[model samples]
Every structure is written in C-alpha cells, then in structure tokens.
Target: MAAHEKMPDFDVIIIGAGISGINFAYRMQERNPELTYCILDGRHEIGGTWSLFQYPGIRSDSDLYTFSFAWRPWTGKDCIVHGSIIRQYLEDSAAQEGIDKKIRFRHKVNKLSWSSSPSMWDCDITVNDTEKMSLRSRFIFLGTGYYDYEEPLPADIPGIHKFQGKVVHPQFWPDDLDYADKRVVVIGSGATAITLLPSLATSAAHVTMLQRSPTYIASLPTRGVFEAIVLKILPSSMANRVIRLKWMLFSLFMVSMCHRFPRLAKSFFLRETAKILPPGMSLEPDFVPSYNPWDQRLCLCPNGDFYAAIRSGKASIHTGIIETITASSITLASGKELHPDIIMTATGLKLRLAGGIAITVDGEPYNLSDNFTWRTAMVEGLPNLVLSIGYTNASWTLGTDSTAHLACRLLNRMRKRGLSVIMPRMTAEERKELEERPFLALSATYVKEGGNVFPKTASTAPWQPRSYYWRDLAIARWGRYQERHGVVEIGLVTDLSR
Candidate 1:
C-alpha cells in the first residue's frame, strides 16, 4: 500500500439486502473467506421487492423451489405462496447465515466514484435520510434490481384525478385502505391485477378488471400429486434439488416452445385457459391477447382462483379503452361505463438500474448504456464492479446464482494474479463494428420504453445478455473469460507518488 493512499474500509461493499445481495454474501463467505464485506440498504428492512410490495394477494409468479437459492432448500409445502412467506424466508436465511449482522439499513448510496489514486470506490451515502457519510471499498456489488421503488410508472388514465373515490397503486398499497362490501375496478391486465382480483373479490361487493387489452393468463398448480409422491420417496435434500431442477427444465422448455412455435403455443394456452372460465363467459376480448404467447410474461393464476372468482359472480372482466373518468364512474370509448367505489391502477413499474445511483470514474460521469457487458455480469471499462440482474424468462435467482459464482471465480483469479484492478475492455475499432442489442431479453412494454437506461449487448459471446442457464453455468464455472478476443484486461497498480 502506498503511504499517501488510505486503506479501504472493507474489501467489498454490497448494495441492497435483497435475494441477490444475500446470495452474493454467502458465496463470498464460502469461496473467499478472507475478504471483508458489508451490505447497505436504503430501506429499513431486508427483501428489496418483497419488503416494498404489500398489495393484497401478492405472491411469487415463479415457483418457490426455483426462485429460492440452490444452497438453501425451500421446504415450504406450497410451490406458490404469499409475499409475507417470502419475506420471512429471506429474513430467516439472512439471520441463519449471520449476513443480517453485516447489513446497514437506511444507508442509501447516492453516488459512487472510482478513485484511480487509491484504486478504490468512494461511496457517498445518506444515512436515515438526514446524515451524510462516505465509505470506500475495493469493489462494489450492485444487488439492486431494476425497477423504481419510490415512484411507479405514471398512471396514464386521462381523468383519473377527477374520480371522487379512492385510487390506489399496488406498489404503495395502503394498509388502512378498505374495500369491504364496496365495488372496485382494477385498471390493468398485468400480473398485479390478476393476483389482486381474486383477493379483492372475496370481500369486496364486486370486483371488475377493466383493461384496454388482454394479457395471457395461465393456470398453474401450486402442488401436484406427482410432487407429493416424489417428496415421499426421496430424501429431503435430494427432493429439493429434484424439484428445483424439474421446474428449471420445465420453465426452459415452455419458453423455448413459445419462442419456436408461437402459433401452437398460443393455441395450447388459449385452449387451456378456456377450460377454466365459466360456461357462459367467452374468451374473446377478456383472455385473448393481441400478442402471441410469451410476448409478455404469462400471468399465473394459481388453482384457477381468478376464474373461480369470476364463476362465483364476485369478479368480472371488462375489455375496452378508457375515455374519461367521472366523479362516480368511468366511461369507455365503446360507450360502456363502470361504476366502482374504489379504483386501483395496476399499470406497471419504471425501470431504474442500481437504485438510480450516480456513478463517476476518475471524476467523469459514467453512463452504463455506453458500455457493453462482460459475461452479463461485469460492464466494459468498469473495474471491480458486478451487477446482479436476473433472467426474465425463468426464475430470477437461477441467473443471480450464476453471476455470483462467476464473480467469485473472477475474484479468485485476480488474487492469483496479484492484480489490483480488472476490467472488460473493447478496442475502439471492435466496438464500432459490433451491433447493439437491447439489454433485456423480454419484449415487454416497460422494457422497450425504458431500454436506453440499461447497458448494450452484442451478437457475440460475453457481450450478449445472459440467457441460457446450462450454457451460462458452464461459462461461469470454467470458461476462459479473459481470453475472449482481448476483451478483458487486468492491471497491477503501482505507488501513487511514483
């Protein structure tokens, strides 16, 4: 260490105490026990998405077996469960591993700057939204998922403010809000609306899902007889791995079928969905989406609860474009009107990477979009930084685990080489010749709308966004990442005074 340079407070600073952050912490402890680290979160609690969202009937769209960490088996009875259960699971995992002790809640990182002189990252943070502090670390792990927690995508209704009754956005659902024996209209066809309708219908007088268009709604079995038999036969540890692998393979197969044979997959989905709806109800505008299957994520309706609610005369679906909102009702462009006591906007979320923290390299502002990714985890020209974005097509944690393993491997390689800094670099000429692609794999609306904020991808290896699990697993475990056409460069820093 140079005499003029100050020692970093910790070797690594992980931002966010969510699933990815916890998983990374565990991997670091297991793979590199000598490295010191701490987790910083803006919120007072853990579980980034699970903690923030408190809407009724909030649950994981993906099965728990696949969504959870592979190291820690999910022994829950139901494959799909409520949000509170997930929160408790995360809390338990963190507490058990003693990772919770290293977390500093309410430490919101505002900006990060890479100091070349010290070969470290200087993080500017706001503690408890009042006191400001700065901390330095040799590396930074961004476990903050992509999405704006503070504000949702603006409600696009023309005259929503004119409505006299209560309006709610699921992102910030009020604990005190009541809709018992009252008519409610949820305005969106996405997952939140699908999940909320059944729960709201149980108590509300009438719950109507009003949407401009339809989204693919599919019924999923929470637990089947096959799973029960398997659990009964295999050991607890083996059963967990078996179920997790089964779901992983099944999910991949379903996605591949949808992508390769859209017409056949759409027909199969439509046919299966029609079987669950009430006899008199038609599948025309209510369940038939304009786009093909898997264009957007399929809204999983567990045990056909959403359809069951519709059959019980408590919930209904209305498809049309909203013209305006009146004091007591909403008027549609097709001359239809809906009178509800409460309105809930399940529109969508805005994408914000790394919790919207400003980044600078040697005092110059850093724009993530300008750089390409290395192994879909590290960014080009960014040293000792790792991003924990998950797969859009499958369970998020699977991709997260892959990134964690690859990051640990990179750190071990750095230690072996006696390197202080490592970055994925592309020659100016090579960068100019490379074609740019969208960072996210999904073609969802929000992804396309807010695409520019994320990093770019290319047609070639390493630069491409992480997609295939088996391929990425192999690469993360044993691929020569740095030998990919001179993309990655490592350096050993010398004394600052020299």
Candidate 2:
C-alpha cells in the first residue's frame, strides 16, 4: 500500500491563478478535454500581479495587443492600459471561458513532493489560512510566477527609518493616502517609477524621480494611427489577430535590432529621448546608461507622458547615489537635497521561482538550481512538473501560452501512449558537455539580485535559454520531444486499472 497507489484528486494541479495559471487551464482543457485539473491560488482573487499592485498609474510595460491573453484578445482602444483594466479583462476572460469555476482561491500550496511508486504528486496546501489539507495529482504545473509577491526588493536607502513623512513601496501602496499638492519623490528609473511620475505629477505640487544611475526611456504611443485604421477596416476577430501579429513582429524586431546593432540602438534611443526632454536638458547625467541597449529592459513611457510631466515643470529627474534620508529630505552624494512629503520606492521586484514552493522527490528535497530547464518549460530530473515563466524580452503571455501548449502536447502524447509518468532526464555524457548559464538573459538588478533562484540554462536545444517568442512557439508546436538524445521519457503506467 504505497502513498501514491490511491486515486489522485485530479489529473493536474496548477499552482497560481495569475495570467500564466489561467492560460494553462484554458490550454489544458482545450487540448486535453478529458483531463481534470484545478487551479490553486494563494490570493482570494484571480488576477495575480494586476490584483496585487494598486499603485497610481500602474500599467503594462508591453503593448496589450500581445500582452493580453491570445484567445480572448484585447478589444480596448489603447494599446497600453492601466492595471485595473487588465485585471477586469482577466476576470472577464476567466468567467467567460468558465475557467473561474476551476480555481480554488485562498488554497495556498505550501509544498509538492513526487511519489515514485504510483507516479503521482502529493501537494500540501493551506486553505483559508487556517485549515490544512493534502491532495494528490498526476501532474503539477507551476504557474506560480517568477517574483516574490509577499516581499518586494528591499529599499537600500541608508536612513529610510528616520524619514518622518509617509514612505511607500509601490508593491504595497496605501489606498487612502492622498498626495494632492504635496511634494513627492519616486525612487528608481524602472518602468514602475516612470509610470508613477506622470501620474503623481498631475496631483502633486512637484514630483522628482530619484535614480542611482540613468536608464534608457523610450516613448511609445497608447494607440497608433495604423492600428486604428486597421481596426476600423477589419472584422473584430481579424483585427485582433492583425494587431497582435503586428505588435509581436515589432517587438521582436526592436529587440533584435538592439542586440545586433547596439551602437545604432543606443544612438536612436538617445536621439529620441533628447527630442522629448525639456529644452537644454542634456542626456548625460539623466538619460545615458552605462550598459548597452537591451542589457536591461528599457523603461517605456506611454505617449511621452513622463516627458510631458517634466515639460510642465511639475516633475524632474535627478540621478545620484542616496547619501542619507532624514526626517523630511533625502540628501544626495553630490550635496543636493530633495524635500518630499511622500517617498515612493518603485525600486524593483524581488525575483523568486515557483512562488517559493518547496519541492521534493521521493522524500528528498529537490533544489531548482541543480537542474537545467528543458525547453524553458520542463526541468531536468523533476518528474511530472512544468514551470510556465514568461519572457523578459517580449510579451509575457506569449511565452506562457507557448509553454502551456507544449505541456498539453506532451500530455496528449503520454495519454495516447498509455503512459502515466513523464520526466526530463539527461545522460551523464550529455551533462558533462552541457554548458550551464543563467536562467534569464537580462542583466537587470532584480535578475542579478535574485541569486540563482531559477534553474540553470544550457547551450543546446530544449536546454538553451528562452529568447524570441517565434522560435519558442515553433518548438512548442512541432519540435521533436522524444529526440534530443532522449531528453524526455514517457515512463511506465501501472494504473491503467484506475
């Protein structure tokens, strides 16, 4: 009587109700209709990041055309929209597809352990913050995103404790705090900070963006004239597909150009940024970054709104190391001081993998760093598991959908073959020749600071780091799963009687 011999609760258990989770559920149901699956979310609601961050002017850094779920398609007029709108769209998407019913909200998965006897995964979950329960499933899909939702990247300011005024972190913004006509200082030059500047500038007497180093900011339109014309002429479904493809190609092209011609891309970015800045504002101290283009993600300023705030004389940009923070002011290394009524730390996210779920195999702990990712979806040496992580270079949903479809395809193969277990393994010879690399290609602070939270990447196929969406999508659809020196194997199925 082994632990896994008993019938599992479900065929699959997805670990988050966020964008990746919802997308996985849809793909699983579509491709494998007979398979039973449930989504477990730690939060009470559906939207993950969108529901979590409620700061003013929070929006998607990528265009909604590609960022939105592929099946539902974003019908909004604006390509870049507010966080609330994205949440509403996700809610509607889940409800319309009946996926919302499959979610078990507030059921936090604490740990997952794979039992080899019957080849099922045992899940330890906490329901409603009080009751503890255990469940079993044949497969576990980790839709848990790559960031620590509970804790953001710590603010590294020297004297943050001494600040008397209202201090806030964008990850945990207070809803009731009003900053009307009050001086505000936003820390960091990332997308969140850029998005917050123009928004806070509208109501605040003054807003200053405080960054230790300059980051490249690129202006993008909320709605393009070409897209508008295409929407007007084409049918709704056709128009949605057209716009999505357009943005997909554009995003890929931009990233490729930046990588292939770094000098040209840097020049173009600098030229465009200078045009939008206030007259006489040089690019040296505030706009120029020491790194090459696409080394880190470029901060997107929708419609030049952040620049508009600066031109209005309500917002300013200051780049210098923080010396100290007193009761009401932040002193810079260059002796300049900024007095702010509200200090918003839009610093960055704390990167984490599988939402910090402790994983085990055969009663032994499984460390993620020890394994290599198989096609950026499945991990080597882990059985019946897949991690759905989005791309940093392109739209997050594209990578998620690719992984989802690939998982479904693998599941279909296993079911048709009467196989109960699927595991990614590597030969000893192959392991020796494999070159391990960082999971993410970006040199962003958060990615570097994450410190091996993600699994390692290799230099070869199905193990190489995830990059462009088109190539990954192709691999997901038609790549050889059994080849590649037998990287993935469909293990024995003894539970056919069930």
Candidate 3:
C-alpha cells in the first residue's frame, strides 16, 4: 500500500471502542489481518456502558458466564460482576488482545455519509473536543450501544426550579456530591432506580422510591453452584454447553414462576422483602407490582441491598402520582409532601438506533422505521449494514457475540463472491406478511406512537426469548443465512447506471 499525507483509508471504521466494537474489530482482523480498521470512542477509555455507570452497588443483572464473550470466559470469583470489574475486564481484554492500539480515544463520530463513486464512507469525526477530521472507509460498524443518550426529564411539574436540593439524573451523577446524612428521593422504578436506592440508603438519612406504576421484580442467586461445577468438572467447551443448558433451564423456571404461580411469585418477593424490612414494615400491596412478571425488566438485588435498606428502615417504597416539586419537597397526588435533600431520577434511557447515525445508499437516506422486518439485525432493504441487537430478555453480550459471528460469515461470503454490497430484498408479499404479523417491537418508546406493533411469538411466558440474546442467536444459528429472504446485488461504479 502507498503512503499518503492523511491517515490511510481503512477497509472498516468502527464507532465506539466498547465491548461490541472491540470484539467486532478483533473478529474482522482475525478473518483478514491485512484489512485496516480504526475504532473511535467518545470516552477517554473503553468499556462503554460499564465505564459510564459509576454509581455505587452497580452490577450486572445477568450472570458473568453468559454476560462475557464466548472467546474469553470470565474467571472472576463473582458471577454477578460489579461495574468496575466489568470495565477492567473489557479494558484488559482489549490490551491483552493487542486491539487497544487501533483505538482512538476521545474521538466522537458526528456524521457519516456514503459515497457511491468510490464505494466508501466519508466520516466526519470530532476528537478531544477540538480537532475536526474526516476519514474514509469501505464499511462502517456501529458498536455504539443504546443508553448513552438519556430521555429528557419532563420538568413540567409546578416548581422544579424552586428550593431544590441536589437534583441528579443517574446518567449524569455528580462526582462531588455528598449523600451521607441527606434525605434522598429516587424517582422511577426502572433498573437504575432499583440499583441506586439501596446504595443511597446506607449513607442517606432516608431514601424513598417513587413509582408512577407497578413493575414486576424477580430475584435469583447472585452466585450459583452450577458455575463452580462447570469450572471444576467440565472443560471449557463442555462448560459452555452446561452453562447454556443452565441458561435454558433457568429461563424456563422464570417463565413458570411468572405464569403458573403468579401469586406464588408475588408472595415469594413479598416474603423475601419483608425479611429485610424493619419491624412493623410489610411488603404492602401498594408497593407490590400488579403487572405480569418480566413485563418490564425485573429489578435485581444481588446482595439484597434493597431489602437490607428496607429492613434497616432506611428505605421506603411509595406509589402515587407526583403533583409537583417544591424548592424543598415533593408533593404527591394525595396532597402529601415529603422533604428531601437530594432527588435522583432513575428514569429509563432514550433509545437511539445506529447511534443516531444517518445511513444512506447511493446518496439516498435509509429510513429504518419504514422497513421493520429485522432478521439477525439486518433490515429488509438496507445493504452492507449489519446490526447486533440481542434478545430483549437475555444477556446483551450473548446476542452480540452471535451477531458478530454471523457478520463474519456474511463478510466471508461477500469476499468469496467478490461482492460490494448485499442488501435485503423482500418481495411485496413478504413485506405485507411481515407487516401483518405482530412483532415484540424492541423499540417501543422510539416509535412515534406507542402501542403493541406485533403479536409476541409466545403468548405464554418463559418460552420466548424476549431478551436480544435468544432472538439473535436463533436467527444467526438456525435462521436462513442463504440469500433467500431478500438479497440485492451491487456492482462496481464503472458498471453502474449512474
């Protein structure tokens, strides 16, 4: 290759040096070491989500066995790994694999445009908050996971700006704020809220959880004997098989727990919760969720921090409509007021697809919403764009690994055929059929209007892989890899009509 003044053009440009990005880059290089690639990350370091969430007691909801990459098994003692450890693992993995040198930290991609003349992409990126640079590549891989951008906290309440203690969003937590000896109010019942309350309660005078509606909560052993057995008796390959089996069985048990005996499931939670509450405190129906189990994500407490806080009388759960916020207090719908020195909004994240990257084909913008039949993260009509959206119900990494493996296969196939672009090409009938059939619709909030878009595959619980892992694995491993659904062929520029 000839040297140029600017950075050499690469065969691929990967956004976000997080786990998915790093892993995908490694796979691409493994397949073809000669293919040049570069990774751009907004943060000064790797680890993506793990690096961003620095709150106390932050841990993985999924077990480490399934949460980690298949290539690198987790040898850590704790099955339910903490955020810091996960961050360290990811960073270490990158360094040990010699993939860290390809990464450009603090380089944030702002815009990407595809050029048909050279069959390449012109990526405009910002680095270190100052420099503006452009890079060209034949392929673009978006490893920017969701959750980086947060939903706007609606401040329509009566007096949000008035006497405010420290108002914090979990996404943008203050580094210097002291929570000890302060009364804290945590708003929202999502995962972040569930994880934060117990940690805050230890130092805060009191922590109150506010929920607008009920959500199902489930608990499992943070560390299990099965993991130990795999490490002791089974070889790595055999251990993976046993781990997969355990995952399936546990998934089934969860399904049954939610369906066959919902009341039993509810009681189980209540009883466990009561054990950690101070005397006279009970798991009241007001605090218990009425929705089906796993309808929303089940809040996890690996070390029983939530119940511990309640048992110590440091935490309380409140369910009601919030009227407004005063300078020093929050008013509920029942005309009651609770004073707090700090307020944390643990609201869910705003979902942005392709990291809000605008993708175009032959200079025409591709609107993903218009083409929604997702097959292994590839839309029906888009070409040369393969996404890694895992099963909504299982571990994120599980599905991501499968997606990366499948992408490797697709890329290999392309290389064998000497093809430039491969686009999904479903017929009108297939499109209509897919449109009519109901889908779980992973991006509900992202939809312009919210309602169930498609019927879930399984009406009964546990049988379905609501998690991205299950769905992606099924599609990648068993679903059609052949160009049957719809595969469009692209020719070189000299042969193009334009």
Candidate 4:
C-alpha cells in the first residue's frame, strides 16, 4: 500500500472486463447507472477468455445467441463463431454501450479484504502488474470467468521432460510459433482438443488427436435453412429474437431428449457421424462415448469440419493411454507410436474462483468451497460479493441475464433499506436442511476432476442452481428478491444510496 496515495472510491467494483463484466455494465447502465462502478480487467486487453488464448482454431462451441448477451441482438451468422469474431463483438458491444470507458486494463485485484465494521471491501489493485493502488467499494462483482488464466492444470506426463518436440498448452499459445507443415499430436478428448484437431490439421503435415477414451461428437449444419429464411425474411432485430427463441427452445428440447431417450440420442449421434466419417472408419474406437448424452458436453462438430478433416486424411483420432513420450515421438500403451514434430496438450483448464484472487473476510482468507453457493451467483454468508458464472450446458451468457438483474435488486434493496452491508447468513439448522450436490454434472475429465475444489450446491430452493433457464428467469431475473432467497442482514449505515 502506498503510504501517501489516496484510495479511489466506487459504489461497486466489477472485476474482469470480459463479456460477463460488459454485460453487467450494460445491465447497470440500463437500470442502475446512478450507481458508481469500475470495470477492472487483470489482463492488458478487454476480451477476457477470448483475448487470452491465441490457438490455431479458437471458436465458440455454443451458438452465438446463447453465448452472446441477451439484451444485445446477435446479428452475426448463426452460432459457432470464430474466436476473433466473438472478441470483436465484445469490443463493439462494449464501445456501443459506452461501457468500455469504465474498463481499467491491467488492473488486477491482488488482495480483497472485507471490513465488517464499515461494511466495505478494501481491494489492493496492482496497476500494470507493478504500481499498487487501493480501491474501496460497497460491493464486488466477480466477472472473472472460472479458470486460472495464468497457470493451466499441469500436464504432468511420464517422460515428458525427455520429449524433444516443442510442447504447447492451448491456454498460453504463442502467436509467433510456427506450426505450418509440422506433424502435430494433440492430447485430450475435450473441447479444446476437438477444436484444435481440425484447425491444426489444415496446414500441419499431419495432426493426430490422442485421447484416453472416446467423446460424444455431434455434427450440425454450418448454416440452417430456417436460420437463413428467418434472417432473410424478417428484420434483423426480429430475426435475432426469433432465432434466439428457437435456439433456446431447441436446446431445452435436446436436453430433454437426451435424458428421456439416451439410447436414441446416442444412436442418432453415431448415425449422423456415419454419414460424414470416412468409409470403414470405426466410430466405435474413437467417436462413441460410454456416457449418456449431456452427461458430458457433446463435442460439437459444426458442419462436420472435424470429420471432413479426417476424411481428407488431414487429421486422425487415436484413443489409448500414453506409454511414454520419446524425443520426436510418443509411444502409446497399445504399442502404437506417433512421430510428431510438435506435441500440443489440449488437456484442460484449471477451475479457479475469482481467477485465484485472494479474498478475505475480516482479514482471514476463506476457502470458497467452505461455504455453499447462493443462487449460483454468490457464496453463502459472503457479504456483498456477486460472482457471475454462466451455464456449462448452454451459452455462458444465459446465466448472466438473471445474475446481473439480481445484483441490481440487491443493490436497490440496500438503498431502500438504508444499509451499507448485505450479507446472506444462514443458521446451522438451515445448512443441514439443504441437500448436498455437486455443482457440475459435466463428464469432461477437467470438469469431473475439478469436483473437490469446485463450488457446492444445496438441494434447498434458491441455494442450488436449478440448471434451467426458465427457473432462473422467474426467480433471479424477473422475480422480486425475497427472504427465501436467503437470510440477508444489513449493517448500520447513516445513508444508503445507489
């Protein structure tokens, strides 16, 4: 802390200038502009997750409607957009909404300490990763998406250090690294690996995706006829609305179908792949997943790009355990050896809370998992902290519509009640009544392995995320904030104003 430096003050502090933070800013601008706020992004850039990764083929697995902000109309080509496009959309939306002005780039929160007596958060801001500054706010909204951007999960493999090939992790892709005409082997069966396969295969000598097991892959049209008709016949705004509605309904229907008829859904996925896959290609060895649909996120092959690459002999999928990594080659447990010039570990991201920012209540750093979540937006008993996390099954932004609205409600409530602090505290009796459950049902290895550290949910109402969009819309978005939401108590304050 600078001894003579004067701390800046704001009513609310939003951490992360990413899409989620931008959406929060838009919502606040729409209904609560009078509330003072600042958008702080840890990175030098504004695009959060998109800006961080500079991989070969980075694109949104989910469609644009659900991935993008609700209030903003996604006039872009339907869904499955490239990362650069998404990044541009974020910047354009922020600039158009005048939210970009509020963003302070390279401002990372080093330490967050809550002052119980003052009912405020004292944050240590590291400017440009160097100079120290202080910021005080009544509330903090964590828009920092769930993953550790600085350090990805360790790809600790046996004989990894002995490998002479250049190893790469998708999280931190060096823009200047030349992989053109290089034989590349990507390890993993998750979204990152699936996305990287076709992309690297385009120019690489050969790209081999090595996975321990098969992952469910589904191929959909690059552009739908109905989507084209809707956009062509209707106004852009109307088209966006109609398309958004259609996608939402269709997403829900698909989810229901997967749960109700897993066998049929699984068969349909394979049947579709059968059409696109190369003749005599065995879907059983590498494409078919043992888990039911939605048990894990289905690998989306928009327009069958991945399969097309396989058919063209540009890429291949290999499934087996790794025996060892030899210089210029990888030996599999199945006695197959793949010689590659480069090995890219598309393993997975490490799930983290608030981007690994240290948060303390009363000067004591509290483990996030120690307390259960509230409405999936905040931690129980944590005062004036709102973490905006999106849905894993659908577009990440879908959950934000409700979360931002709920934050507005809480802030408004605080003003109406003339209070500085609002903490949702529950008794032991209440905690016991709440049913315990895992936060995510995702079958992806990264997600499943993150179980111990990931946030927990209660079976009790308002404590667990219903995982249904409509439920969130009714309770958090449009509905009034009530006591059943939690037992929120206020601290003494002479004046409370947004």
Better of 1 and 4 by TM-score: 1
Give every collision pair in model 1. none
Q: Which is the winner by lDDT between candidate 2 and candidate 3?
A: 2
Number of the candidate with higher lDDT, 2 or 4: 2
Candidate 4 local lDDT, 79-108, one digit each (tens): 788898899999999999888899999888
Tens-place lDDT digits, model 2, residues 401-494? 9999898988887787777788788889888889877788888887788858888888877788897888888989888877754456656664
Query: Candidate 1 — worst ten consecutive residues by lDDT sum?
Result: 489-498
Q: Write the per-residue lDDT of candidate 1 for residues 216-331, one digit (tens) a residue.
A: 88888898776798899999889888888888889999999999999999999999988988997788978888998877887798888999999999999999999999999999
TM-score per candidate: 0.97, 0.97, 0.86, 0.96
Segments of candidate 1 deviating more than 4 angstroms: 1-5, 484-487, 493-498
Evaluated at residue 358, the lDDT of candidate 4 is 86
Number of clashes in every candidate structure? 0, 1, 18, 1
Q: lDDT for model 4, please.
A: 0.82
lDDT of 3 by residue, 1-498 (tens): 233432337767888777788888878767656567888888888998888878767888777776777667776767686799998998888888888999999887887776655566778888898999988876677787754353443434457677558888787667898999999988887777788888888888999988777555555566678778887887877877677668756765775576678777777777776665567765564457766565555667776767677777889888888888888889999897889998887756655666666667667876655665445455655656666555455667766777676666666666666766655665776545432322343322322232232212222211122344455566655556445454566753321111
Per-residue error for 338 in candidate 4, Å, reads: 1.1
Model 2 misses residue 144 by how many Å? 1.0
Residue 402 Cα positional deviation in candidate 2, in Å, after optimal superposition: 0.6
lDDT of each: 0.88, 0.89, 0.68, 0.82
Cα RMSD, each candidate? 2.2, 1.6, 4.8, 2.3
Q: What is the lDDT of residue 490 in candidate 3?
A: 74
